[model samples]
Target chain A: MNDTTPNSYRTGPDERGRFGIFGGRFVSETLMPLILDLEAEYEKAKTDPGFWAEMDDLWTHYVGRPSPLYYAERLTEELGGAKIYMKRDELNHTGAHKINNVLGQILLARRMGKTRIIAETGAGQHGVATATVCARFGLECIVFMGATDVERQKPNVFRMKLLGAKVVPVTSGRATLKDAMNEALRDWVTNVENTFYCIGTVAGPHPYPAMVRDFQSIIGKETRAQMMEREGRLPDTLVACIGGGSNAMGLFHPFLDDPEVRIIGVEAGGHGVDDRMEHAASLTGGRPGVLHGNRTYLLQDADGQILEGHSISAGLDYPGIGPEHSWLHDMGRVEYVSVTDDEALAAFQLSCRTEGIIPALEPSHALAHVAKLAPTLPRENLLVMNMCGRGDKDIFTVAEALGSKI
Target chain B: MSRIDAKFAALKAEGKAAFVSFVMAGDPDYETSLAIVKGLPAAGVDVIELGMPFTDPMADGPAIQLAGQRALAGGMTLGRVLEMVRSFRVDDQTTPIILMGYYNPIYSMGVERFVAAAKDAGVDGLIVVDLPPEEDDELCLPANAAGLNFIRLATPTTDDTRLPAVARNTSGFVYYVSITGITGAASASAARVAPEVDRVRKATGLPVCVGFGVKTPEASAEIAGVADGVVVGSAIIERIAAGEDTASVLAFVKSLTEAAHGA
Candidate 1:
């Protein structure tokens, strides 16, 4: 991997959608033409003023953009260190940052004249977000969830059903996010005619990883403007949880050229990184390999078979991170860290107690890292953590984790 | 010349479309799968697509996926798959065998070394579903260099701009996915497949063989009328997965091949 200069991070996935040696379209021939078509449509859509116009309009009116960058004053005082701020994307419609990318991709799907929408979701946050847009557009929507996730994340499943989208439970492999993604890819390859795969993160084959990153970059773009308007400069550090690294890419892409700002990505260290089969910390615990299209950091056995990743946060239970995250980690531009489930649970409760805000377990991993990083920094230094999702869907899981019956 | 080239040439002289049969290696067990494969040519199968089962098969439907699971459960490693091919080669040498699966196992085995071992195993071609033309440098080029034909799949969506790319590094024959979906997800219509076969045939001189969604003898006959070869995978594997003996499975395959040849 070459050194990432200040200006280099903005332009990723060259023509063939490669980030260094990662992020190419590693798919079967059936899906290759579809991926290429998506690439062409995205290329035109990125430049089309009308496309952005519709997307911005939806962002402001429907999906709720410019999610507040709130000063976590009480939490900062409790931590007693660098002033902490939260990019409260949980305040967005559908209650998470997921809607940002969902809205953008749905609009593109509509532009491409695709009438059907399908997606894979783990925590069901992305599923609910996709179902919301499909409902708005009256497109036929199907969300594939792991059978295990369907059982555990029941509230979001109900929400998807209420929104009139069919949630298919994928029973293959380990039956989690990775299996759900595999099933969704199968669906995409099978129904390439009218179906548009609304991938929930900055992963998958080409155009998806880069395109989703561009859509979700609204978080970083908004943070840049919001922070400047408030603090007159970029934050000292930017932090976001990395499942497939969509939220982190969204929060970090804009600041990559900002030399003074440090970027940190927190991966779900379920149990611990040393617990080989029990963590989703791909960058921290895995070697580079291929899965779900892109060649990225993957948790696999010696025979190259993908291992099921365990995480308390379903959203972070994928075996691989995005290819761009792999590139960034290799380039030493973004510091990748892992926070265990116990640490995340502690941070989850800490946020609710101190800031009166309930954070989803995914971002609680990021918060756990922030808690450690913030205290050591000088008091004047600024820190921004992406509170990417709300905790409403996680109440049951949290209760169970805390040993309280909900 | 590669066995695939010679087989196509022989089929052309005989005025018949090639009949290709697919079965997951080590399905039910290595010995059964080897028996099924070794019996294919005599059963009228022109070429054999031996499935190298992997942990994740994103392009296959339920039947093929289950077959892969059974194969993996039967201890079907890459070495075991090569062993199956080598065992098949011990008795027969004319029929072309293509190792078909995702790229991970081959990659895990190291690309050049895997290609060398595959050639040594009498493997004639490869159909790695995940390694597209964009990733030719990964395995396609190495396999081709090692005297193994790297067959590429041309789908309905491969437009004029993309066809050239998909056709560039392609050898052996172009495997035309009859439907726009995964293997065995939907029935293929000859009416929809005929023009696609024509389109791909125009761009590349390599024989176009159609697969995916082809199950019945009638479907194979219909597809055979339009394309150079008709490939049947999930149907054959379904019979094996149902615990059909080798003779019964070979008889069923002979019926499909006769129907194709009759076309």
Candidate 2:
């Protein structure tokens, strides 16, 4: 609470759990009392210090926090722009930073005495993370996925099944992540007594946007220390891709106070902005509306109906975004941009071909922006990119691009 | 003529069930929707239920969701929606219009503000999808203060213990979700709802209106055997979404009048 100690590094969630205009607890009357109870429990848990110590222990021993900030010297030399350093979240357990947030939420879910966990998944990364935690914690877990995603991401579906998560195939209109989200919400509404929905993104009503962001803050906290050790200062820009924006928010939170570090979020520009197939860029082409219990920007038609989003990357395809993201984009603090599927694929191939590292398509959009923006900056300048996830699950996509028989 | 009590008093004397029809206000476009709202009273639609479109319409099946999609596609907004409800009052003053949807939008709009605007626009009741009997304190109590009914849905999910609680909290009419699913899912059977209506009647003396899956005149007639009112949505929205003119649709609605009266 002291003035000298920076506000962002205080290591506790806000009194009401907000990040600028992004987080709050706007929920149903039935759920409001529960969220209030959660807020009180979380507040008390924070004061316990033991809970903080346990989170630290998991982050260090089981979940692996303070992941290395590796200098991409080879790629940095090739790109010939500013020095590039990658926050190795891909090296974390479960092959992405998604596990960190899931673990935290699962712990909290247990604390709230909820025994069942239900989630919605698009590309299946978050599903895998949720399934892993449910197995670890011995909780019954159900996952709702659009039928289309289940077909495209078979490996992840199997991974979830192996982890004992029952994946429910959603048959709603368009049969995608949006439908799965609707299905999960319907399940929550019908089973509010004992079931808890573990949302895969930093969106939905109030406390979720805030709670998920707080869990993801570990990414930013680790990168800050790692950067200070090697460069003796913060990077000039921080870039991350947004799909309901959990990964991006995770990498942006601890750095919120670093006024000098420019933050950029890349949204999926599917085919092109003009064609519906070309843009799932809610930030670029969305309006404010209420969905899944909170007010946020959504890609809706003229009559105010929510539209189905399209993207080459199944993971980034969504019609609406997190409410906090709508707030953040409006605040003008973080620069929001868009990248095409071709651009992301090209960047994915380049990073793999040049540096022996393949990135998930979601973060590749961010890398594509880095590919375009890094070389233009002065050599003395530094860039920090959250290499959120690996592309082990994208072999089918890679094969198709390579023109190989699957 | 002024509110639910007066309307029900008149209906009590006449011994008639309220003919409720659900429509997404501003479907396809604002003008067409306004026309339909104006035409409902003449068509014998006793209570007009206007659904406010939300992106994740969990309680709606494909047909009505598409109707909602068409309205949203036509550039209908919350502000325009309010204007449309206000527009209904311009032509008709006696009929009750209930604004129904998932709770997200109103919660986002600030409950007090939305309830006040809905009241000012002459809306009489609300059916919030995710709202249950346990959560009636927020929308139900506030809406009651504004003289609006916070109608509750009793589905197959409601057992004997919950049925009475739901009936106690609700007003205007208790909406019986005829099935466990969303609107427009299946054809309703009288067998499915007869016992439900009997249970709800024993639970409370409030007027009970049956909805969800009532797609045909025959279905309405079947529901009329037990419930006080019959609610229809998808069959009408399908007409609107398919580009049917209101005059023709209303003519079609007029045919269903015999179904409610069983004559």
Candidate 3:
């Protein structure tokens, strides 16, 4: 809206919802009208002071805004290089940063007079957050989870159920996140009249990737002011793990114009980024293609059939990343890297032992990269990573990985 | 003239709406699927819509989705689909064949090469579900340039304001999805479809074919009475998925085709 908007970072997508050719509304004719309506409504809501006031009230009172940027002093002292700071979004009401976007979307859903809410989940943190919001708002909620994910993330499934949400187990094609996403899209098209699809991450068509990022960008906004107030300068490097890339986008968006600040995104490298073992490292192993809704880097084969991405963490097992991340990767604004399951497991344990904080496996992937990058940089260089989620749901997974009975 | 254009013109001359049958290129296995495809035109089907099976068919319901999974499990790649068409073209040259599916496989095949090969293989048209008019420059325009009909879908949600854009650059026939849902999710009603079909015909001169929910002979007849053509996909796919033989499937297709022609 202003000419002073930075040329390097904030400007994107243009009017057609493209993030420099990465993001566009790639849905079917059945969904085209609904997507267009959503775009218009979101645009109107963006300019409405009433909408912002309602969102702020909920963020402050219900969802708990301004999650702390806690300094991991013990871990920093042990790493002996860059000073480590963790944006503790895990302390959010639903135990993850997912609530920040969920709260905003559900509020918008209420504003739009939608009666039903639908979502697709991988690790189920998002499902819980959505269920929590729908329960608070008294709207009907349905969450589609891959059958494999349902079996693994039992606690999150139960939490969603407790919040009065129906968790539908999707038993199609690898029975994972992508299939669940497909089922959610089907649901949205089928019930586009009264249903609002609250996408868990920033990967769907047009307005979703942009809208979800704006809602989640509170992470970066708070981190910016907090770092400025506490340390008098921005952190040199920002790190977050990407799986459909909401948390990473939330943490990276505000710092995009800060030319001096470097942003790094960590991806799940299941066993390794090799031909034999499967991984969800879309940027490193995948090429640009269309899936779900947006045109982005997808883990598709020679024939363009989507391949199931394997990851120790269910949350990071998606075959694609957000379209914005693809644009950033192409623009060379943010550095993207991958960490293996073993490395993430090590980081999960180390953080629990050193900092007394148990991070979800998704962010453990980011922590794994931090372990490597922190030691390489100077001790004074401020390195901040988003502790996007808590690890309670991952205990069974961790136990199995460690070859121990839970 | 292109087979699609000729077929529609013939239907228009005869005062009859066309009956289009859709089947996955390789369901159960490639050979049986090929047998079923070859038997379709003789079974009174006016047009053949062959599915290009993708790993993720987001817009399809259970019957079509399961059919695709079986096809993919049986090793039905894009190459195999084209092979099926080439083999079919050797015998039947008059019946229009449309390859319907998502865009990823075609994108991976290199659009120019895929369009050229589809044309060479006797494919008459395409109905890539995920590619809208906004993305026409990506595949639709090129496919059209290669002399292939790039058919577009019009839905219940395609308002008058949006109908023109959906109609632009569309050829062969306009696919009017009768429901606001995935394929085979709901039963289509002629009462709700007739006005929409009339509206779409006004937007584009291309003959509008109604699809997505027309499952039975009666439903086909009812829809055929109101539209230029009726496309039945999941119902035919349901028979194939139920282990029906080629003869039985052809009989079922004949019944629906007769219903449309008689209507």
lDDT of 3 at A264: 98
Structural similarity to truth (TM-score) of each candidate: 0.96, 0.76, 0.98
Residue range with the least summed lDDT across 10 consecutive positions in model 1 chain A = A1-10
Those runs of model 3 whose alpha carbons end farther than 4 Å from true positions after fitting are: A1-6
User: Which structure is stronger by DockQ: 2 or 3?
Assistant: 3
Per-residue CA lDDT of model 3 for A1-406, tens digit only, reads 1224346778776787888778888889889888888888999998999988988888888878889999999999888899999999999898899999998898888878899999999999999999999999899999999999999889999999999999999998889999999999999989989999999899989899999999999999999999999899999999999999999999999999988999999999999998763999999989988898888999988888899999999999999999999988888889999999999999999999999999999999999999999999998899999999999999999999899996
Superposition TM-score, candidate 2 onto the true structure? 0.76
Ranking by TM-score: 3, 1, 2
* Residue range B149-242, candidate 3, lDDT tens digits: 9999988888889988987888889999988888887877898889988999998988999998889999999999999999998999999888
* Per-residue lDDT over B24-123 for candidate 1, one digit per residue giving the tens place of the 0 to 100 score: 9999898888888888989899999999888789988988889998988887899889988898899999899999999887777788888999999899
Candidate 2 per-residue C-alpha lDDT over A39-110 given as tens digits, one digit per residue, 9 for 90 to 100: 666667657777778778888888777788888888888888978888889888888888888887788788
A65: Cα error in model 1, Å:
2.7
Residue B133 in candidate 1, Cα distance off native in Å? 2.3
Q: Provide the TM-score of chain A alone for each candidate, in the order shown.
A: 0.98, 0.92, 0.98
lDDT of 3 at B12: 95
Q: Residue B145 of model 1: what lDDT?
A: 80
